[model samples]
Target: MNRIIAFLLLMTFCSCDFIEKKKVYSNDILDEELKTFNWNDVDEYPTFESCNSNLDNANKKKCFENTLRQILNDKLAKYEIIVSEEINDTVQLKITIDSQGTFVINNIVSNEVTQTEIPQLDSLLRKSLDSLPKIYPAIKRSQEVKTQFVFPVIIKIE
Candidate 1:
């Protein structure tokens, strides 16, 4: 009876080893597959109409930034806001471009002074952003991906 019990225990242990081996092999295969996969990195950055002339990646990025800044500056100039005291503040705008090349305002961050002093600031900014032209969405491995961009506007009341 003792011999029978020992044989049964040995068989159970061997079956467990087989199950563990299968799991180990499957995990190894998955790891190897994961290493071969290409993760999401932008192959091409988002572009503006003015940036289309630049063929180089770095030049395209620079042109896009310059054009965007110019557009924002131009649009903001249309709004007339007066400050009683000379103040300096920075407004950070988080903008997102969807895969379909639609602009979406994610968030706007500013100091308390800007919020309180410039009551119409939010609406003005939104209007300025809404006036912008459509942008080309970023590409990741030939697939268009939604991208987020942060723009900081420095406001100085002289």
Candidate 2:
């Protein structure tokens, strides 16, 4: 009987250890979440003062683009560019807005004909961007992030 009782006690303790074993927590969920997250997308687009912050994401982006287009058009309109030949081309402006809300021109894509026709066009665009209104930086994951995009400006001069 004594031997049987000792065997039973040993069995109980071993089974208790097996049943009470702690599970090791893992970060697999976090890793999966990070992998699934879209890094290229921003939660909020950059904005100007005239753009309403309460607007939805799509409208906010539209307002920002429209405001920038209008400002550039107005500035360019002030310059009386008279070309010798009829020129019709689209100049793609590669622009970047830094995390600090500063505007930067990465590149200006224009054909040689356009460049030759308007030598001061590049400088004029740069100056126009320099005089832009204060901008708000884009937001991603609740943090300010830099954004870049290409804006096409059509040049039509008779």
Candidate whose lDDT is highest: 2
Candidate 2 per-residue lDDT over residues 1-158, each given as its tens digit:
99999999999988987789676556876888789888888999999989987899999999999999899999889999988999999999999999999999999999999999999999999988888889999999989899998999999999
- Candidate 2 residues lying further than 4 Å off, grouped into runs, are 1-30
lDDT, candidate 1, equals: 0.81
**Candidate 2 accuracy as lDDT:** 0.92
Could you tell me how far off, in angstroms, the CA of residue 91 lies in candidate 1 after the best superposition?
Answer: 0.9
How would you encode candidate 1's per-residue C-alpha lDDT over 74-131 as one tens digit per residue?
9989877898766699889898889988888788898988888888888888888786
Question: Each candidate: RMSD to true structure?
Answer: 6.7, 3.3
Give TM per candidate.
0.73, 0.81
What TM-score does candidate 2 get on C-alpha atoms? Answer: 0.81
Candidate 1: TM-score? 0.73
